[model samples]
Target: MGPSRPERARREAVAKVRDQILASLLSGRYRPGEKAPSVRRMAALTGRSRRSVHEAYRQLAAEGLLEVRWGSGTFFAETHPLALAPETSAPPPALPAIPLELRRLAERLELGEAGLARLVAYWAGYARDHVELAVVECNGEQRGLMARELGETLGVRCREIDLAELGPAGARLRRVSAIVTSCCHRDEVAPFAEAAGRPLFTVSMDPGFLPPLLDALARGPLVMIVRDRAYGPVLSRFLETLRLPPEQIARLAVVEPDGLIGALAERDRPGALYVSPLVRDRVGRLDLDGWRELEPRRFVARDEVDHLWAHLAWLRARAQP
Candidate 1:
C-alpha cells in the first residue's frame, strides 16, 4: 500500500532537484538580486529535467528565496525569508497535492475519504514491518559515517553494508525498509537496489564543502594525515574532486603529529600537511614549525545532510506502512 515504485522515484527526483538548487543558492553561486540561470540551463547544469528545475524554482519562489517573472526568467530575491508562518496559525487544507497519477488511480477505484484514509493506514503498517535501513557504501569508514548520520537524522535503525554485503537477489536486503548512500556510490549500489526493491536515496555534500575544502585545496599539494588507514580510500576520493591529480595528494597514516613530523623530515614534498581532527588536535600540541596544517577537519555540509533527511521523511510520510 506504500507509494508505487514510479511515484516514489519521481518524488525523489523532484526533491533532489530542489535540494541541488538550494545548495547552489546557499553556496553563493547565485547571489541576492542576481538573475538566476534559465530553467533549461539549470536543468543541464544539474543533469535534471527542465520540469524538475521549474518545479524547484516554483517551490523556492513560494518560500521567498526566488522570484519568477514571466519572460524575464527567475531571479534570486533581494531579501530571503527568515521564517515561515507557524503551522498553528493556519488551517490545514482538506487534501494535499497528491500526484496526478495517484489521483487518477484513486478516482478509478472510487475510493471515498474514509476508504482513502484506511488505505494510507494500511500502507503505514506495511512500512512499519521493515524499519531498519541499510546504508550502502563503498568503504567501511564511509559506511560507518553514513549509518551514524542517517540513524541520528531519521531517528531510525540504520546499519552500514558495502555493495557486496547487499547480496544480489537475497534475503539480507529484503529486511531493509530503505537504502541510503553517499552521492558517489549511487551507480555502484543501483543494481542491488533494484534486486532489493527498496527505495534508494543519495546524500550530498553541504554548502560548507566549498569554503573550507576549496580554501585548503588552493594551498595544496596537501599531505593527508589519516586517523585510520581504512579511511584512506574515502579521503582519497574526496581529494580527487580537487583539480590536482592523486599523486599530488600524499598521506601519512599515523594519527600522531610526531610521526607526521618524522615522516616529513624524511621526505622533501612541497605544500601543506592536512590533518584529520584526530590528528589536528594533537598537531596543535607539537611544534612542527615549518609544516602548515590546514583546519578543515570535517567536510560534511548542513544542506547535504538535509537532502538525506528529506528523503527519509518522504518514506515515512508518503511511503509509510
Candidate 2:
C-alpha cells in the first residue's frame, strides 16, 4: 500500500532530527561516550514528538554515531570526530573577497536562486571574520605535513589529529570551518562528509569514487585530488553530469610526474606542495608530464570550490545594498 502524506512528513522529520544530532556531534557539541539529551529533551529542543527523536536516536545508534546503554543513557560515538582531520595549529585565514569571474560562472550554473542566495549568506558570515578549520588525516606523518602547510599559509593555529583517535566533543567540532582528508578511501570519507556540516576535500587513490563523493559532500566545498590518468576520462564525464561549462573545465591544471616538480616550483603560492618523501617515492616515478591535476584546495581555501560558491558569495556581498 502507498504510504500516507503524514507518514512521509513524519519520516522526514525524523531524518532531520538525526541530521541535527549528527551535526551536533560533528560540531563537537556532543562528546564521545557523553550522554546525549534524553529523547524527551531532544523532542522539546527540536519541537518534534518524543517518538520522532526516539526513532532518530535509535537509528543513529545503529549507525554507530551514538551508543545506547540499556540503563545508562545515549552517548555520542567515541570516534566520531576521528571521521575528520584533526584541528589545525591556528584558525583559518580571513575570508577573502569573492572573485568576479567565479560569480559569473556560478550564475550560469543556475543552482536554484534561493539555494544560491542561502549559500552566499553563509559565505558572508565566514568572510566577516576568521573561521576555524579542522584537518583529519589517517596517519601522524600526514598530520604533520598538513599542520606545517596550514601554519605557513593561514598563519593560524592548526590542530593535527588522527581520525582513529577522535572522541566525542561537540565543542571541538563546531569550530571547524572545513575538513580536509588526505589519501582517504571512499568509505572512510562519506561518513565524515555526512557528519561534518561543512565541505570536504580528499586526496583520492581511486578516480571512480570521486563523482559520488563530490555529490555526497554537497553542503559546502569538496576538492578531490586524482593521481592517475585512467581516472581523467571518468572525471571528465562526471563534470559533464554536473553540467560544468567547458571554459570552467579549462581552468583545471594537470600535473605530470616529470613536470610536477617544475610546475610546483614555478608557482610561488603560499600553499604550494614541496617534494614530500611519500610523493617522491611513489607518484613521482610516474610518467606524468602534462596531465591535469585538480588543485581543489587552492579554490576551496580561497572561499569557493566550484564557480557556484564564488558567484553566490559575490552576489550576496554585492546585494548587501
Candidate 3:
C-alpha cells in the first residue's frame, strides 16, 4: 500500500521545518532556552499546516535542535553546537551621511560637530576598511531619515530603535558600535550610558550643564554640542583650569552661529574658581566645581557638528578590537 499524498506532504514539510529550525538555532536567532514560536505562529509564518509544524518540531527535538520541557513550550537547546562560517575577507563600506532634518536638528542643537567630524576623519585614516553606524531614536521620522542618509552615504547598516520599547541591556543596544542620543529622556539616557561602554554623542540646547558633564567625561572622550554663545566663556574658563597643551586644546572647537573654531584665549582665567554662571544664576550658590582653580581651554567648541561626528568615528574605529 502506497503512502497517502497528505502523509507524503506532511513528511516533506517536517523535513523543511527541521532544516530551518537547525539553521535558526545555529545562527543565534533564538537564544538558548528561549521559546520557539508556537505551532500556530510557526504555521502562519512559514505558511505550513499547524500539524506539520508540530511534527517538524518533534523531529527537531529528536535531532537535538530543540528540547521539549514537558509542561513548558519547546525551546532551542541550551547546548546546541554552533557551526560558524569563516571570516569574510572583504571589509564593510563607510557609514551614511546625516539626514537633512537630523543634520538641521544637530546643526540647530550644535551637537558634537568637532568630535563627529574628527571621528569620520579618524575612521577614514585608520580603518578605512570597516566602519558601521547605529543611530538610536524614539521618533520614526527622524529614524527613517538617519537610516536612509547613513545607508546611502556610508553603505553600512543603520537601524532605528524606540526608546520606550527598549529594556535595560536589550539585545539591540549590545549590537551597535556607538550610540547617538537624540531627545531621549534623561532617565532613559542614564541607563543606556551605563551599559554603552562605547562612545556616546549627545546634543543639547542647554549649555549650562555641559562643563561639569564634559569634566566627568574626561576619563573618556566626550563631545558636547553647544547651541548658545553665552555659555562659551564659562566653558572656556573651565577648560583653562585643565592646563592641557596648546595642541591638545586645539582639538576643542566651538560650534557657533558662524563656523567651527578652536577655543579662544580671550576669556579671563581668574585664579579663584566658581560655578558656571548658568548654574550660579539658577541655584543662587552651589559649589559644583571644587574651589581649586583649573586652567581654561579644556572645553573647545566646533562650529559644525559633522566635524564632531568625524572625530568620534575616528576614535571608535581606532578603539575597535
Compare the candidates by TM-score and give the number of the best one. 1
- Point to the candidate with the largest lDDT: 1
TM-score for predicted model 3 compared with the true structure: 0.28
On residues 124-157, what C-alpha lDDT tens digit does candidate 1 reach at each position?
A: 3322333568877666555665665555444457
TM-scores of the candidates in the order shown:
0.46, 0.30, 0.28
Scored by lDDT, model 1 comes in at: 0.56
Two-way lDDT contest, 2 vs 3, winner: 2
lDDT of each: 0.56, 0.47, 0.46
Residue 42 in candidate 2 has what lDDT?
A: 98
Ranking 2 against 3 by TM-score, winner: 2
Query: How does residue 108 of candidate 2 score in lDDT?
Result: 57
Question: For model 1, what is the error of residue 103's alpha carbon versus the real structure, in angstroms, after optimal superposition?
Answer: 27
Ranking by TM-score: 1, 2, 3
lDDT of 2 by residue, 1-321 (tens): 223579667776786786567445434466667778998999999898999898887766655567888788887767532132233232232334334443453365543334233333334443333344456655544455555454343433456655765445334644554555664343565465445444455533334334443432332222222333233354455576777765444333334345555544553332212233324455543333332232222212332233323322322211110
- Among all windows of 10 consecutive residues in model 2, the one with the lowest summed lDDT is 312-321
Better of 1 and 3 by lDDT: 1
What's the residue-level lDDT of 69 in candidate 2? 80
